[model samples]
Target chain A: MINRTTTAALAAAVAAAALMSSGANAQTANADKERCYGISMAGKNDCAATGNNSCAGQSKADYDAKAWKYVAKGSCATMEVTLKDGKKRMGTLAPM
Target chain B: MPAQPDGNGLTDLQHRFAHAVLQAPLAVPSGIRHDVRPTRERRFGVYRNNVKASLAAALAARFPVVARLVGDEFFTAMALVFIERHPPHSPVLAEYGAAFANFLEGFDPAADLPYLPDIARLEWSHHVAFHSADASAADIGRLAELPPEALGSVRLGLHPAMAVIASPWPIVSVWATNTHDATPEAPAAGWTGETALVTRPHLDVLVQRLPPGTDRLVAKLAQGIALGAAAEAVSRAHDSFDLATALSTLFGAGAITTLSQGSSS
Candidate 1:
């Protein structure tokens, strides 16, 4: 018969395995995410589809406001910025 | 003595290529030539220029705020020196510039900006946060579900992208003013110490200035200390430690990722 301590350890192990699987699922879900505009730093954009440049690291200004990096869908609005006017704004889904 | 290839070994070839990238174009490794031309010095020069430009661009990309503070010309010169000394060990360019902050501290030219190194440190933290793996924020409401006696043993885990940067200068203000303002104004008077929290809760990386004792508390919690012990440590150091406000800030910013009981038992 399994001891009480061993049973407790088994339950903990199962819980940990569940947590790890959930974390892995989240990573896979975010893998195919696309770039969200207004969050990329200068020359740090993943890629621009507007034909501006063929590769990453080409943006000419800080927070170019138009360039973006691939982020999970529904997360574009979560990239918040404090504007020059001291107003907070969320990153746009498309080039701005 | 003329440099000779070590019996055409791959290791030797890689060493020579590494040297070629770090040093002058004239020393471009032998037996390595352009695809179209055979060991053309001009073609090698083109490659050298591109490599240097791209590396410099990477530095600029990683440390834009630092670049703005030092101005373009000076920043480029400094970046060249840093690139020569500490060439990237990793293929990921985003992982570059880890030594930049420390380099600035020892750089004689940047002695005037005593705060420059700290600013670089802050920027590096921001860079790291931006690329760090994502994690779901902890559910603060779960704490209430725990029995009061078991609460003391709960260990908190920080988000994968969270970091605390403690500096003697008002680094958060300095970073904020320079980043948000088109024409950055002078630093505010009554400047004192600052402790900043860098976190990427969702898609955005946020840099927030922590209150007096929060950094200590967060640091302790991050070390896997249980709730009671971490709070007691903070209380001993700072009698005014506000647990409510600090917890609110931590949860609001999504800095805490996991909460597990019996870890410290």
Candidate 2:
């Protein structure tokens, strides 16, 4: 259950994740299912795929079976990050 | 002589992270370290909180039943002490709590129940075995084919994950009562003593309560004593020690593997 403080924190995290999600579809599809829309990629593997709109893929279902599917309206935008050991790798990470 | 910004190495980062984590509690010097105001200090606080929670969860993982035994408040206190004293030495979180049982032994609050620590030990042993490297049991067909003469002098090899623990307390029963859904009994009394065998034969490691005298034999085998000598020791400990039954029980469970032939060492 997301509390007031946690909900706010998650909101910020979701914002951060959304900004990072481009080009992550392939990686997100294979990752856990809790993720509504994630840009999942590791190392140099650059690919994208969708699980399902509700939460889609492994991530959506991974979190909970009862979670409803999300029908994305606009050109899909979600959240992500590119961590390189000690620092954050900077790039828009948007879908091309 | 020069303040070169070129020194950003992992060592520097580790030190920074460690300091940040330790000092997080002090942030509320006044309603929180916003003492470092306009600073993303909140994020730093959150990060420190996360670190503490993760380590606490790691300790809890090694001792779930212990957590249940102590209650959340006491468990939190215990976990805080364990983390400060035994921060993980390795990056692998799965293999984190070897020293926990001992820590519990020395823990002031839990010291009252002398048996608690040993039960923790048994649990930690279970955790390690669960993640331990897998080795298929030695082929039974080949074992049986070996010459009968070879059996007397054969040195039995235990799988890497085999662990045997003997505690003066009835720890195995205590551990079983809590971890498994069984009828709760009165607080244990007959400290006639207990011994446990924790071994990973395959995917799941089994923790079983062995007869009183079985530990000496298993310990002897663990120390590289030949099967015959180990048998001799167990027989001496308990006149009724059934060598055939015990050996077959272990062998059937994939507990015993690899027999070295030659002289009983």
Model 1 lDDT per residue over B1-265, tens place: 5555655676788877877876773476776855766547677778667877789878877777788889888999999889878878888887889999999999999899888999999889988998899999875556545645555677888998998889999888787666554456666644887887888889767777776788998989977888766766786799877665566567656788988876543
Classified by CAPRI criteria, candidate 2 counts as incorrect
Candidate No. with top DockQ = 1
CAPRI-style docking class of model 1 based on DockQ: incorrect
Leading candidate by TM-score: 1
lDDT by residue for model 2 (B1-265), tens? 6665756654576665666565544443332334446565667767767877878866765676677678767888888778777766677877777888888878888977878788788888877887777877664444455544455556667777877778887776676555432244443555556677787787555666655566676778778886656766677779866554455445544566787775644
Per-prediction fnat: 0.01, 0.00
